[model samples]
Target chain A: MINWSAFVVVVVVALVAAGVLVTLFSTALRVGDGDAPWRRPVSVGLYVVCGLVVAFGLYLIIPALHAG
Target chain B: MLVVALVIALALFFDFTNGFHDTANAMATPIATGALKPRVAVAIAAVLNLVGAFLSTEVAQTISGGLIREGPGGVQVTPVLILAGLIGAIVWNLVTWLLGLPSSSSHALFGGLIGAVIVGAGIGAIDGGVLVSKILIPAVLAPFTAGLISFIATKIAYSITKKRERDNFKRGQVFTSALVSLAHGTNDAQKTMGVITLALIAGGLQKAGTGPELWVIVVCAVAIAVGTYTGGWRIIKTIGRGITDIEPAQGFAAEVATTATILASTHLGFALSTTQVASGSVIGTGVGRKGASVRWKTAGRIALGWLITIPASAAVGALAAFLAGLGLWGIILDVVLAAAAILVIFLRSRRNRVDHRDFHLPQPGAFVRPKKRKKAVAGG
Candidate 1:
């Protein structure tokens, strides 16, 4: 039997994860290149968040980490 | 024993094809957008694949997964049946490669096995419900799910970034593409390991229901890594440029979407086709970007390729199983024909060679540039 719930989880997680990662990264680049004083810290914060998301992705891929 | 040896060898060969055929899924966009040089992109993908193969084997355990009846009460699965199945898969892979299509290697393998099992055993040997739920439904869903994600991601990416900053997404592609390669290794190399383990069990060299041996894992990993390094330039050309022109932002979006879908599916043990998911992402990006045109003809052809891959490979598998059933000479004949067919396909490919250089240059008849491509197509 098809695990409809699992399928739904995959779809929802993929959408949210992809949306957040790209949004943060793109927003970082958009503002980071600006001359405004506050832009530097804001972009840096966004990049760090993007890095964390990627790390979480690695967590999912690696079985040992994923299981734990 | 000899038959089992052949099955092992063919399974490895299929594994190799699986690697090269899928290298594009991870590396094509990076190569196309110049984020990484073609050779370097493939090298990174290869190394990641090598590392990923050792990461997990959860998917490998359920590879056959009720598709074939294989216990005490189940139909006997012979080495020759597997060999026929392998031949079917390999031949279809080569044919699709020569035509420069991005079809699913997993489906080809499964279809081959299904056909061979039915012929070698009986129609009752296949669990119809499992096939429908697992393989068929996933094939229908994978592309749409990936495409939807990519579409939404691409729009957000473009809308948030300025024109100049858009190209900066190229840097992110390096990481996302690498993730995909690692995911590919985790998902794909294990399929071959599962097959070899099945052969070992069926041949009685190992116990039934156990996992692959360490030696088997090492060899399968090496085979797939080497195959990824070799790179399927023809198929890469199709995916990277044929379907749509990929900007750095679109590439980043497509790769991110692909990586997310594949990892999630792998975690859930949802055995969908990576190629389908990757292809879908690219097309989704094409549609998402304003004013960007998707080559509907090419997309349609690729869709047709996916539709026929199973039945076409199944027919060949059935034929090979029929021949292989005749005995020793039968298997030998199947081997000879497969070898000859493979050689011919390789030679034919040389007539319109695609290489890393073509990533930058539009070969007259190549699909890289639509304008030049149309003229070339007409002249030819």
Candidate 2:
């Protein structure tokens, strides 16, 4: 049982890592352009998307353990 | 058994996408440097990627057998699981591409498998040893090695071509680019072949955990070749221009570094992310050159993505497994979710078409700035 969750957790960690990576890369690229066109909203969109995936995943996956 | 064929096709599709999306990694610097013409360079890379697809199956074997354990159900991997994982990866890739972030498709694939497998077979199914030694270790090391090599190579490339005419140096980049393309084929194309082979074994169409078949090898190669030809221009811009301003010499240095590191890892079945290595090399070369900004914040973002891919995929994978096991409703939800993800990606990509032309004409330092010495050295 531990192993199962562990694997899932590791993969979750990987997903978060990929998300953070994009955020970091974008922040770096967008450095100093205080008014660059369409960058912040784009960054927000990415983060929001990542958040949704993470949240939705938890919502769907966590319930299964109890119901099953 | 038919599912096995389907999985194999999906795997090849992933490989094809990998080839095109990652085309920037292998050929960008060369193209940026004007060493190889865009069309010719892609052709060279495509042929070599096909060749490389045939060169090895150890990594594929590792993925199919070692990374994720199958159930008493006889090494089965549901097509839905594979498809779900692909959706996760594809979505992530598209998002990153739009932002010009050079994230790793290989890691995404690995994470997807880990995700899907965890949900489908339980965590006990994963081989921690394999994921760590085979995937993580290479992930950490390849970029470091590439960066180091690129640092040295950049220094030398500049010294050698220090006084050559600009056009002459550009000419030299062409040959080197071709070499990198060949090397790219060898290193990257084989990954899909491995995935499909794993699918076949899982579906019990072949010996369990065996090497890929000859047909698997051929088709995977062709798919990736075609993908390479199509060009993942968003990545090309992100990798080529965003990391730092890459001059022709820097381009040459980055390509050589990327090629060497990629070829060496593929041979050993380490399954490292070529995107990360290429990005690191490009950034490193940027630092090796004078007055280059490291873009530490962007590097941090990419690092975060690397950190999440496995776990996120696994979480999604686990959910997929649970739902998939739940019977029809689960399948329906899965299908709806997959469709939504695909639609989102398609809509987003349509807005601003990323094409090869992004490579041909740069934005004339649209993103250049002052460099911090310590930060520059760090990315280097």
Highest lDDT model number: 1
What fraction of the native interface does candidate 1 get right in terms of contacts? 0.70
| lDDT tens readout by residue for model 1, B1-380 | 99989989999999899888989999998888877889999999999999999897754543467888876799777788889989999999999998889999988998898889889998899898988898888888999999999999999999999876776787899999999999888878988998898888888999976778899999999999999998999899998988988888999999999988887886776766899999999999999999788999998999999999988888889999999999999999999999999999999999999887777653332223345335547645
Candidate 1 local lDDT, residue B12: 93
Off by over 4 Å in 1: B59-63, B361-380
Candidate 2 C-alpha lDDT tens digits along B189-286: 66676666656665667697566677877787789889888778777766766677777657756665665555444433344467877887887788
Alpha-carbon error at B148 in model 1, in Å? 1.0
Best by TM-score: 1
RMSD versus native structure for model 1 = 6.4
Which regions of candidate 2 are displaced past 4 Å? A1-68, B54-59, B69-84, B164-167, B207-211, B267-271, B362-380
* Model 1 chain A, TM-score vs. native: 0.86
TM-scores across all candidates? 0.93, 0.72
Model 2 has a DockQ score of: 0.02
